[model samples]
Target chain A: MKEDPFAIKVENVSKKFSRNLRRSLFLGTLDLAKSFVNLPPDTTKLRKSEFWSLRNVSFEVKKGEIFGIIGENGSGKSTLLRLIAGIFPPDDGRIVVNGNVGSLIAVGAGFHPHMTGRENIFLNGTILGMSRSEIKAKFDDIVKFADIGDFLDAPVSTYSSGMKVRLGFSIAIHRVPEVLLVDEVLAVGDISFKRKCMERMEDIRKKTSIIFISHDMRQVERICNRVMVIDKGKELYTGETLNAIDFYYKHTIAKEVQNIDPKLIVYESTGDIYNITLNITNEKGENTEIFKHKEKIVFEFNFESRSEYQNPILGLDIVSPEGITITSLKNVIFGHQRPSIKVGHNNFRVILEDNSLMPGTYRIAFKWRKQDNFSLVSATGGRFAIQSEPELVPFGGYFKVKYKWIQN
Target chain B: MEYKTIYTPNQRFKVNIFKTWYIMFRNVYDYRELIFQLFKRDFLMTYKKSFLGIAWILITPLVGIVNWAFLNYTGVLDPGETTIPYPAYVLLSTSIWGLFMGFYVASSNTLNAGAGFIMQVKFPHEALLFKENFQHLVNFTISFVIIITTLMLFGVKFSFLSIFFPLTILPLFFLGSSIGLIVGVINIVAVDIGRVINKLMELLLYVTPVLFASNTENENLQIALKYNPLTYLLGVARDLLIEKNVQNLDIYLIISLVTFLIFLLALRLFYVSEDRVIEKMI
Candidate 1:
């Protein structure tokens, strides 16, 4: 089979870092001396306090692809970008880039404070690998895009941070590098500037292959053709953006559950009298920790009782992270107080045709009442997250609404 | 459209001499504009918002000359066995010494000043070192004018060889920059090394025949000064400019050869360690 060429290919690469900076420097110098004699470093051995920051990480990005990388801080995302940009070499494996690479890893990185904005445009442009002629040609456009007007001739030290960032970004994008590495630089500047930058990025994406590292999942879902999720220097998932997001959610839940004490979850319990378990799943019957907004969901509760009871009531409340109730399901609300509940195992299922809750984590709390008002058991049933939809506005206020407009 | 980029872990001190040279040369060649811009920045930023502005460049050498003159006037400093007058001798040597010292310190601190850029951008960091050292040339040129004025005012027989004096100091520039580059790289990882270099520079100024002529009666001190590299470079530069002494030209040329070799070695180490060391710094 013939191999299809990739725009960027990172093969089994690994990087080790040490926490102790002084010792790391010592080791680095030792390595430098050894390399002087053409000796290979001892990759197989781990010295006193060194750890692999990136270990055996591999991925391929196609040309004109907007590849998204999402991870918590210190997940080797920056390291990967630095390696690809040739800012630094990897410790092992190989990364192949066929075209010139550029990075907006940090805006205003090479801006000299005492230089005028125009001078820094040339300065930073050249630092980003733009030739003098390229900057000269784009000089007017860059200045206009930066929108610094009269301040172009003023020293950068006199320019506001926003102006500096604007100038830096304008110069970078105008260069139109073949492969662009963006590292959360969009978080800077004001809203209008951000919008303009996003538009420019969208336009650039048509011609340039980009590796975007962002914590903004919304941006990732909207723009990325594919997404890779990483945690603690390991690849958790790499595929469709939405699926990768779901995997990330589950991964987070698994991590959170590690520290949870099962005993603390039982508020009141008579283990010999009642046993209960709850599970939430999507309509397909497969268990899922995340559900889309307005998607059908099933909450199945399994209860086993040693004896019969009259008028036994169960209550379920879907509460927000701040403990405010968004919605609830109570057997009493429907005026159907069960005449009696027989002994032995019993199952209760609540189906919501459309879970219209907002996009956030929600806790499902459950309580069992005996007779009229005696609370028997109360505990958190489960937790699930509603993933935001693409079309909806990222409403800061809670609870998405479905309403129709009337024309008079 | 497919472009391949290979990234591998920096093997323990892997020395591919040719590859290192190629990488450094290519990056420097490609980013020459940036290098010039950096030099421009250093030059402009040094004088920005300062009340004295470019006058600050002359202050260092001027201050040294005044102190030496005051000491000689008070009879506290003894001038023994000098080819030129005391004031002229001290001023010329001090100015030359100032140029070398500026190159050394500026080269050593170049990366420190641009640590933010080096950590974020993947450009030839050697450009920063070269820029910082190059900026000192402007300062040296300023001091050169002052030295010329002093030579004429004092009625010293300044030779046409003085025109080639700047060329003679080229080897000192290479030697100082090479040492500074090595020390600067070390300073990034171990900041204490910078302090050590600073202290060493101060101590060496006293030992080198910069402000005071060598005390030949003290055999131990004379022997130490004889072996001091700066002592010879300064002697060679002074001879060509003031004394027209060419008897030891062979020794000066030999020193230039050794300094050039050291510069090549330092540059190689710089290329080999740049990426890894800089990444670690970030």
Candidate 2:
């Protein structure tokens, strides 16, 4: 038998949901009843209050590739993930997941709140499709990864939400299935733990293919090799991470949508902004995300606007991966000294010489302000990384400041 | 390690009938450990919170028997004479009935008992039924011991046929579970099914002549017992346990066959609707 290159193949998959609860149950049960006495369900049509949450969505994830699904809330991202997890059947089309699937959709899903954390590892591990011997072999790894020391004997009900997520993630990642479906679970835990999860994901990506669904573009760009943007249960674009993200902002946001109440703006104005993309370059002028210590780096922001303004202020913030703001840079506001932009495209640059950032991942957050009151019009873009060499400067801080004590 | 789950609607759902039927009993071998752990969790957690704890197993059946025994002695309820003493007779009968009810309750409440797991994780739902039975098995064993001791206290001698106690009662367990399994799925759609079944089980206990003699003086009660399949199962099992003249032995065998078939049909119903019911579980 020849093995397929794609780990997961979904063809013309669609799922319908009902807005009315009572009718949903009635029609759902009616479908079950129809299954009896040899009646086929009519998945092609819709009934009262019934609408397709996912429509004709098709995408293939290659082996060892991290695929991404990004959408606004209620845009059917979760429904897509759940459908792939085998939690529910797609109304039409076929989904072929090649191996055992591990779901991080709802971590600690199999956990009994009344049971101890130690007991839950065994319990949840089995539900995750691991054999008892497998669970026993990986028990220590799970505990250490969770890092919830001394709380192993305590009931899971006593655990904080973060603690539960940590233990749940620990149990799940250790199982290491052929395909893993992650749905916003990385957003829950604290920074260090989130970094640990991200690191673990990067490590496991070697053997396991992942389908990650998140609203965070930075996380998506940082992880996925390909992404699909879903809007109102429809696939607008699916391809390269940057292009899919750019496509998402171009189509999904309600720039023209108006709220029912006159007083409430559905969303704040983004300063006639279409969207933004970012990139970084080293002294050799070659683009790179990882940089050596004490290297000269340049930040580039490519902005697209619906209309242009003079003296528009563009701001940048260099943030640590731990979500801490290390520093902020802005243009002069007193004389309204700022870059002028045209209607179509504009570019800006900020330079940093002798960058002394130490051994960890960092992100650049871009903020665009109006020319008049300088209120934030929009905030878009997460690009650039100043990766540090952990092997060299193991104890390096955020930055190496040039200072010395004067005969103290 | 090599499992590919393909999810589809309609035709795939129909194909699953034969597929689920084939692997219904054979393929759950991997889930045995899960079943044991789930049973252990429920068993340990149950005993963890109470002062009297596991003793309630013995105490619940005994209390039920005493209530009828007191009624019989007070003459408020005149049940006919039994081959053994009244207390011994009622004890044996209700304990047998209790074991039968255990299967029904366990199988019927299978989905809801694992509500936490069911609402979240997707494993074999069949494992929950096995887990439920494990708890009932413990209760049945303790209750059976009490029944034997009560019979001894009354100085009733055991018949050699009593060796077949476990064997003879096997059909009753299946019969109870078969009915429960179908009702359990129905209960998911409308909880009224569960409530109605509970009331029906109580009514069934009286009509089956569990506490009273089968040859009761009341005409309506006698006819009810005569028509009830449990009368042959429960009565003949009790008879075979003590110095016995077992009646309805042939009907018991036929009923046992029918029970097995109904159980198969019930399992089919469960497999077909199991996924559908799970969709509505939340």
Candidate 3:
């Protein structure tokens, strides 16, 4: 039989956290009293305000794999990471990380403010499981990577929050721990530093197995060979990144999401426009709120015109989740400037081929205006999630562009 | 020691005293570097914010000794006659007693001092106790210098036996750590225990014969002093240094032995309850 190539293996792990202070006080004492005689807490069941933060969650990360954990706030993702890091012991079951485990759980958690940055490099590095010699070996590299030139000898209290994070991250990444547990601390670094960290992580990924817990779906999809989606301390899905993300969006957001207004979303200034309805569908004519890269999406709208006008501009705006408008489509830039239409209940369709919107939830803001006067009427409604193949989505741009490199 | 440690429930608490000591010793040895680094941080930190810096360590006791000497000189209180000068006697005794108090403070503050590291990092938390104790030792040595100065100025002579000070006061160190460990645990879960213990240690200080001679004329105070563990733990260490006769060796040995056992149990309790401490800290 082939040997299992797993770096961290968690089996039937569970942890309980008391919900309130009074309960924590009472139960903390009770547990301490129980432990005084070398006995364990009664983990088989819950008593009082205690609830399992993680319950019977099991998974394995193979050697040299970048595993991702995705979940909503208050889910057991952090608890599981803590358990595997041995920061918290499991209430039941086992966790076996074959080699030493390290974490970026909270960057610079061990830095003392009165101490100089050089001093903290030694202290925090040791606390993070680096020996003095290893720290000395990487001291110059750590300072260079942190890029806080003049402040290297100043007390860490003088460093800005970002500088501290950079220093902490710099100290953390120098060594290759067999299993590294990373939280969302990566989101703190600036663009260039973030890119450097990703590159460094890629370099380390050849030898290290990483457990990355992040809300940044793009990074998760880009780096993770496999992803696990969890909710309320239970596993929802655990396999391939794209499908896990799909399952996550379909479950978490789909449940409590408010339905879009079905009535005609029209403004008073939208002259000649009567009742209207917008529809987004896949090429097969089935309703879809999702589209993949290069997929075909048909935008259909039906409206009644009280009066006819020449060359009305049809507009559709796709806005990213961050509220920045990605693009706006105007009929003047594309198809016919004028189309023959009946005055009542006229339907029009626009097919958007080769959709290149990056992977994120985008809202559509629709507008219509007279081409002659240039005055506009606008209404925003409906949102859809677009997923792209992880490789094609380039950095530093919201919308992916269609381009080809020519080497002559 | 295994490189990999498995944590599980300690169900049906059985006191594994030997195993507990082994793990505690092994972990302390392994984390000596962290302990030293932490000690350095605290040693430099405690005096930084204060205007007087570490002079306050000497100032508090100096002021306390002066107040007591004035009371004794005015006949407001009879502390009985002492072999050495009155000020010197009180200074050395309280300083010796202060060692116990210092250890108690240091050990009690261990869990709170490392609260930040405890919540986020995974390491042996008990290693903090060593750092706390080490930092206190440096502070105590500073105070000890002042004690030597006070004794010299008062023309007090130390016996040849003063060299055994560390060994003589071993019980006080153990007693302080034991009491502090439990009190520290209590302070975490129930902070009010700290206030109660503070008042209680005040009462304990009066009965421990630190400020007065053990042979005070008052019968009630004498009886309280006789039963108090410090009557031997703190008294002998001071008595031996001041060239006084060792009193009640049997009781002293018994108290020292009892202190050793309590130290063992406290070590077990502290090592065992650390997980809960981590839980409460977070």
Q: Pick by DockQ: which candidate is best?
A: 1
lDDT of 3 by residue, B1-282 (tens): 114444454421343569878888898899898888788777776776788986787886577656646754676554348887665677788788888998888888878877666766788777988789888888788768766766566466887777777786578878998888878887777777677996797688889877778878798998898788888888888878886576687888888999989988888888777765566777
Identify the candidate with maximal TM-score.
Answer: 3
Q: Comparing to the true complex, what docking class would candidate 3 get?
A: acceptable
Residue-wise C-alpha lDDT for candidate 3, range A1-408, written one tens digit per residue: 455578888888888888989878877777766666566777778888888888888899999999999998899898888888887677888888877888888888778887889999998888887888889999999999999999999999999998999999998888678888999989997889888888888999988899999988778877899999988888888998877876776665443223433344545554666667778888999998767767888888787877666677777787766668878876765565566445777888878786876655666777776667564456777666665443643342566786898999
Per-residue alpha-carbon lDDT of candidate 2 for residues A284-390, written as tens digits (9 for 90 to 100)? 76876656668888877675778767786667777775658787777756755577778888787777776877544566665567667565454533434444332
- Stretches > 4 Å off in candidate 2: A255-408, B1-3, B11-13, B16-19, B65-80
TM-scores of the first chain across all predictions?
0.69, 0.65, 0.77
Candidate 2 collision pairs: A270-A377
TM-score of candidate 2 to 2 decimals: 0.77
Query: Who is ahead in lDDT, 2 or 3?
Result: 3
Better of 1 and 3 by lDDT: 3
Candidate 1 has a TM-score of 0.80
lDDT of 3: 0.78
